[model samples]
Target: MSTAADAPPALREPRLVPLHALAAGIDFGRYFRWRHERDGDPFLVRFPGFGSVVFTGTPEGARELFRAPAELLQPPLPNPIEPMVGPASLILSRGTKHRQDRALLAPAFHRSRISAYGNVIRTAARAELAGERTGAAWRPGTRIDARAAARAITLRVILAAVFGIEESRRRDEYTTATTEFLNSFGGALFLVPALRRNLYGLSGWQRFTAARDRFDELIDGEIRRRRAHGDNGTDILGLLLDTRYDDGSPITECDLREQLRTLLVAGHETTATALVWALYRLHRDPETLARLRAELDTAGPDPDPLDLVKLPNLDAVCQETLRLHPPVPIVLRRLTGDFELRGIRLRAGDTMGVALPLLHADPAVWPEPRRFRPERFLERRYGPFEFAPYGGGHRRCVGATLADYELRIVLATIIGTVRLRLSPRFARGRMPLTVPHNIATGPHAAITFDVLEP
Candidate 1:
């Protein structure tokens, strides 16, 4: 097997690479594309705090990395999002514990369980369309921020699905706390670890910790109430409370908090960003939007969201949007044991991942990749490695099923309900660079759309 010395070519000298790493965090697609074009697949790059990582854009490379033994891979420690997700989060755990946690949480997101929430999804979308938030009333000629609107809709759906918090008062409280917690950790806090330090209660980290504490208090109170009342409902939290390990012990409160937080954070933010991108892309391309609208119109008024999710053109549009702008642009795994890939040997502690942007844009896999074309998805089915908006393998997103279902339902509902066009300023504007927002990357500026009379 090839040794460390035989690793893939480096993007730059070690000293200069942190600069590139910072750039990647801001605009991953552009940076990864530039590096992949120059260094070819499986190039090595080092971050200042994190160690050397080899990223590949080829399907073969993705297949190898994802197929590696589950025992030999784990999410890299001191992960930037560790603060946001907490240590016990399944996203960070490993080995037997990870498997057990995954199994326990899997049922909550099963297709059947998610399908049951179709009404919840559609209700949330309709509420948003009718102006749920301040200044968001959808009158013709009124401009609304797509990202904020999408976030509001998704937040409601996730809150209802996870905690069964359908009461407006309680939902508003959770929304306020959760939004604050998420907003506290901005891109700077994520990209520059130094900014994560608590400085006399004035630092971003301090604000985030304060917000987290409040959010935790709310969650802990809910858990205690549920336990006291022996509440056993079908929501994810209740499901988790009732579940037991092989040893017959229930999950600890600490684990429960982390898991719930993970569900709220990962479940909503990523999907919201994708929704925003879908709306942005569709508005920018009238042809694709018209095609999707036509498909939705055929479904008739007041169609069940379950049926909306099955519409081929709607699915193709969501898939195509994800290809161009995956919320998480790369999937990384730190090696726990030596591994070899594409003739390069990587040692324990080294990182390996697939850069989704490069993989999605590979000319061999996607024709006219830069162009906004939803029909490509209808023409041929792509493998997981070729188009993984959610990462692949055992560590693939637990909420994948629900996210996919929600994206299609919500997108279709909004498009079918009202006529919207990109605000004049954004109508002819170039697509904005994506930057870190909370945990996911999204269009840098607010994407605004004007409600139009049908």
Candidate 2:
């Protein structure tokens, strides 16, 4: 509750980047480089006239920043998602609200639930990858749109985890539409420039909200039908309904909707992105692929399909992919109040976002940051805060572990059954989120692969 004037800015962030470069792309590292590429300083720039500055070094500043004053340095969620995800989302909440939401939500994400969700992950992976046919006519250098393959299974896994839907019953067309709607809302980043004058005058949020609004009728209808049938809510919804706040109130329907929306957006898209990166890296580095294959083959068949989260190498591939191509390449934090550390000054109400793409790519922090080495994570020397596609601290991703489990299971199950290849020239999407060249982003040897019967 401290304002900028009361708390005072004390942290001295080195002037690493100019403010104007933020307009280019969501991930600045993809487009520009600062003077000292090793330090990766310029990549982690601050927006002028913001509540705080971005620190993209080792975990030192992140640790200091997120250490919980309970007042200043609020969670840095984009305002655009508020309408889509509802205020109940863990990502959008700050302070007491965050704590309350997290308490109610954490039970479903506990280790026990993670264990329970494993079978769901495996089944989803198999169901998606099982239908194809392999032929000797297929050449060795063939490639598939692994991103699409990854996204399909990931979507089903999350839905199964949250809604317990089976492959036969899954609504593919509806879900695909839903996914595109949420991802397209990222366009608001472009709208940030059009907001002139008034702070409350939200720019083009109506459009973003509309994208998410398309789902409300469907979601609300489901909730209403479940309530009407006197059906026991079974998925994550069942868990949320069973929880109570410290104030002794059962969560309202609105809250459940927000959390579900949050899970849909964060849970699926992120894992899909990483899986695409994982498959991309695996195809590019055959040694990594072979070793990963050996790990899956050696682990034997896991009964609970979701058991892929435990393989150290499988875990390593996910870790390495996340290190290289994070779904969330930026970490945004708004100042709750004035605060400072590392000789840097921060004021309340200022917004700061870390270029995670650059930090993960930092050579000083990660040796040969560009190399696809899963073993680097095996060292276990790196802190969770140090290497995150997921954000850090109390605001860290609510589904981080589950996302990991989902990614690893998909990687193991698919690779265990079949190999993939694609045409090199068919490479899709020029930027971070790989789109298919034809139906989906694909085809450079890195982006595509052939699915082979192992």
> Which candidate number maximizes TM-score?
1
Error of 1 at 174 (Å): 0.8
lDDT of each: 0.87, 0.62
For candidate 2, write residues 12-119 as lDDT tens digits: 233432333343233344443342253443223334323233454456655665563756656554453454566677887778888888888887788777877777
lDDT of 1 at 255: 93
Worst 10 residues of 2 by lDDT: 435-444
**Which candidate number maximizes lDDT?**
1
What global local distance difference test value does model 1 have?
A: 0.87
The residue-by-residue lDDT of candidate 1 on 100-212, one tens digit each, is: 99999998888889899999999999898888666457889888888888888999999998899889899899989999999999988887777778688788899999999
lDDT of 2 at 107: 78
